[model samples]
Target: MNVTIIGGGAWGTTLAQALTDNSHSVLIRDINEAFVEKINKRHIHPFFDIVIPTSIKATTDLDEALDFSEIIVLCVPTKAMRSVLVDINSKLTSKKLFINVSKGIEPETSKRVSEIVNEVIKKKYFGGYVVLSGPSHAEELILRKATALVAASVLKKNAKDVQELFANEKYLRVYTSDDVIGVETGGAIKNAIAIVSGVAFGLGLGENARAMLITRGIKEIVSIVVALGGKMETAYGLSGIGDLIVTASSMNSRNYQCGLRIGKGMGVEEAVGSLTQSVEGIRAIVAGYEIGKKYNLDLPIISAAYKVVNGQCSAKEALTSLLGRSLKEERYW
Candidate 1:
């Protein structure tokens, strides 16, 4: 299959390499001309240590990327998805599939990536849309490490096509599901937990504290997911608990780092400035807060995360409040 990865960031470029290895022709498009030039000429994304094959075409033009590829792997971040989808919608014919790898809710509407795609499709032409998400990250995928991700679509056939698209011995293990709500929810909620875990690490809290927080974090996430029309079981899968474990435990997670900075007594603006990449949890917490309110979900952790990020509360205050919560039964069920 001919594929276009419509972003030039690490995830997009990394996926381009994976698709190329799968014996599919891959092209990557970046809005940044420097990133485009670097990938086209050097075959390596400047953000990573790995090198991609020069055979993968990298360009800045959307039309050029769309011209040959039938399946577009939308790897851009959530904030950029709207404009990018709008640009691509007119050009998309009925024959193509779009697989979203980006994770985060649209800030204005608090819609998931799949929702955004559905909205795009509703507004104009029809196209196959699916969201491929899980604990797998760009770093692991690019290195060809063992990884598994869900191929989620509203239509099972579209999910099946995505499963076939990336299933391979060299790169990824793909699972198909019509549970798009669960899959997308798992991807979005994990980042907030990761931020909390980051704060624990920065505060010199032991692994036990982080572990406890993460386990409870999963419970909070499951509540919100169920409240907002996602399956509780989905949170236990790769995109759910799997994602929580990876993002919360790893230093590579930008959200985790952002939390760490806040825990260390730095302001949100200061923390954001110190990091080069955008910390998506900053946006996700805000969206999650809105979702929690709209759905009447008890999401104290998500609320705390929003307060810390938005400067309404300090990280220390957030942690203290979490620890001082009213006694409740601990039910694993």
Candidate 2:
């Protein structure tokens, strides 16, 4: 299938590179003119030495990218999804599959990226929709690490197109799921938990604490997932279990690193400014809280995360508060 990735950030750049070598006609769109020029000239994003291809056409025009496109990959940052979709709303034509690789929730709407798109991106004009998510990290994928991911879509053919298009030995292993809601929710919620674990690490907490947090976090997040109409089992699959493990444990995770800074006594704005990349957890934690309120669910950990990042509580206090919460039966209802 012909593909156009809708953002030219790190993940988008890596994906374009991977697909171009496979004989796919790939186009990448970015609002940044410098990014477009750099990729066309150097086959790399100016931010990093990315392994992109000269043949992978890069443009600043969404209309240009959408033209001759059968698959639209939503590769923008999680927080940027809404504004970008709103801008591209009129351009989304029918018969194309939309694949989201971004991971987080829409803060104001408490909607996953796909949900935001579905609500705003008039699907009747598009070819199709899909979500590609899993343990795969952009940096690791660029380095050609063996990565496993799922391409979830409401339409089976879109998922299969992604699977057949992305599978290879060097990079981007693909799987498919019709449970797009579950896969999308799992991908968004796990980053919030990863921030909690990262705070645990930065506070000099031991593995016992981090491990317990990570494991129980599974239960905590799964509750919200099932309550929101997602499959309980998807939480255990690549989009769920796979992503949670990677985000919570890896130094490469912006969310994890952001939490570490907060745990070390830095302010949220300061920590966020220190990093060049946007962290998904900053938005995910807040969205998780908003979601909890709408669903009337008790999410102590996520609640504490909101407090910690906003400076309402210190990391130690947040951890203590979580431990001090009222006890209840461990149920997954």
Candidate 3:
């Protein structure tokens, strides 16, 4: 299979390498000429420590990459999803499978990645859309570490096809599901919860506090997922609880690191500015807050995260307020 990855960031480059290892031809498209040139010349991503496979090709031309593959993998951040999809849609002359690996809701419209794709790409030209998400991170995957991810689509066949496309028994495993909403919702909102977990860690709140945050965070995620018409069971699967566990516990998560900085007394702007990579949770918290408001859902942790990250409240204040909320029976459903 030929695959065109529409981003040159760490995740995109990492996927290209993985595809090439699976004997699939991969082409990477990026707007940065310098980055593309460096990858084509050195087989090494400028930002990450991983080396790109020699078989993979990098280019700045969208048409050339689009024309070379039957499957287009989007690895760009959620913020860039709209423009990237528009560009791809303009060049698309026929239907092709699209696999979105980015996780987040659109800040302005609060739409998921699939909704943006559907809006940009006409239905007649639509082939299939699948969201590849879960606990897997680029840093671990690039080193051929064992990892698993979920491929979700409204159509089960589409999800299965994607599962087969990237499945590698040794290093990577792919699971298929028809719950696109659940998968995407889990992937997008977990980042916000992970920030709360990081704040706990930064405050030296101990393992119990971190555990409490993780458990309650899943409840918040499930409530929102169910409210948005997704399966509750999906929230317990790889993309939900699985992803939350890994991201909240690891330093590799940019969202967690951002929250860590905030808990250590740095302002949100200063912490965000200090990072070289995008902290997706910063955007996710705002989106989650909006979703909670629109749905009339109770999401204390997400709300607190939004307030802290936006500088409307300090982390300590937010934590105090959260603990002071009215007591109620724990509900898993």
Candidate 4:
């Protein structure tokens, strides 16, 4: 399969490398001319330390990328997803399979990446859509570490195709799910919970607090998933609890790092600015808070995370607020 990846970030570059190593032709498109040139000449990303496969090509032209491949993998950030899709729509001459790897709700409209893609692309030009998400990180993935992911689509065949595209028995495993909503919801909101876990770690809170936050966090996630019409059981799968555990516990997670800085008394802005990569949890937490409000759901941990991330309350205050919530009979539903 000829694949074109639309972003030059760590994840995008990693995917390009993986696909190329699998003997699939890949073209990476990025706005940065220097980054493109670097990849083409050196097979290395300026930001991430991973060595790209020599077979992969890089381009600054979106039209060229769209023309080069049957499958387009979108790896841009959530905030850039709409604009990038709109650009792709303008250049699209025919139907193409779109696999979105970005995870997050649009802050302004609370739309998922697939929703934004559908809104931007013309109906006649639509081929298929698939979301690739789970606990896997680009850093680990590029090193050929074992990773599992879920490829979800309304159409099961499309999901299976995606699974075949990326799955390698040695390092990568892909599972298919019909519940796109469940998969996407798990992938997006887990970042917010990861930030809270980082905060707990930063505050010198030990295993007990981390366990508490993770347990309650999954409940918050499942509640939103159910409200959104996704299956409750999906929350326990690779895209849900699996993702939450890896993201919240690992220092490799940018969201967790952001929270760690905040927990150590650094300002949110400072913490965010210090990172070389985007901290998606900061944005996802706001969207999660909005979703909780829209659904009239009681998400104490999510609420606290939003408050802390927005600087509306200190981490300690947020923790206290969470602890002070009125106790009810414990329920997992």
Winning candidate number (lDDT)? 4
Model 3 C-alpha lDDT per residue in residues 1-333, reported as the tens digit of each score: 889999878788888877888899989998989879878998887578557787878999999998998799998889988998998888888888889999898877778998999999978778889999999888888888999999999999999998888989789899999999999989999999998898888877888998999999999999988988889999999999999999998889888898888888888888888988777887888988999999999899999888887778889999999999999998877
Q: What C-alpha lDDT do the candidate models reach, one value each?
A: 0.81, 0.83, 0.88, 0.89
Counted clashes in each candidate structure:
0, 12, 0, 0
Better of 1 and 4 by TM-score: 4
What is the total number of backbone clashes in candidate 2? Answer: 12
Per-residue lDDT tens digits of candidate 2, residues 76-125? 88778888888777775555667889988888888887778777777576
Residues 133-152 of candidate 4: C-alpha lDDT, one tens digit per residue: 99988888888899999999
- The segments of candidate 4 whose C-alpha lies over 4 angstroms from its true place after superposition are none
- lDDT per residue as tens, model 1, 1-333: 788888868777877777778788888888888888887777776588567888888888877888877788888878888988888876665455778888888868989887788777544345678988888767777889989989888898899988887888765888988788888877887888888888878887889988998898898778877877788888888888988998998877888888788788888778867886656777778888898899887888888888887788878888889889999999743
After superposition, which runs of candidate 3 have C-alpha atoms over 4 Å from their true positions?
none
**Model 4 accuracy (lDDT, Cα):** 0.89
Candidate 2 residue-wise lDDT at 119:
79
Q: After aligning candidate 4 to the native by TM-score, how far in Å is the CA of 239 from where it should be? A: 0.7
TM for every model, in the order presented, reads 0.95, 0.94, 0.97, 0.97
- Model 3 scores a C-alpha lDDT of 0.88
True-vs-predicted CA distance for residue 268, candidate 3, Å: 1.6
Worst 10 residues of 2 by lDDT: 45-54
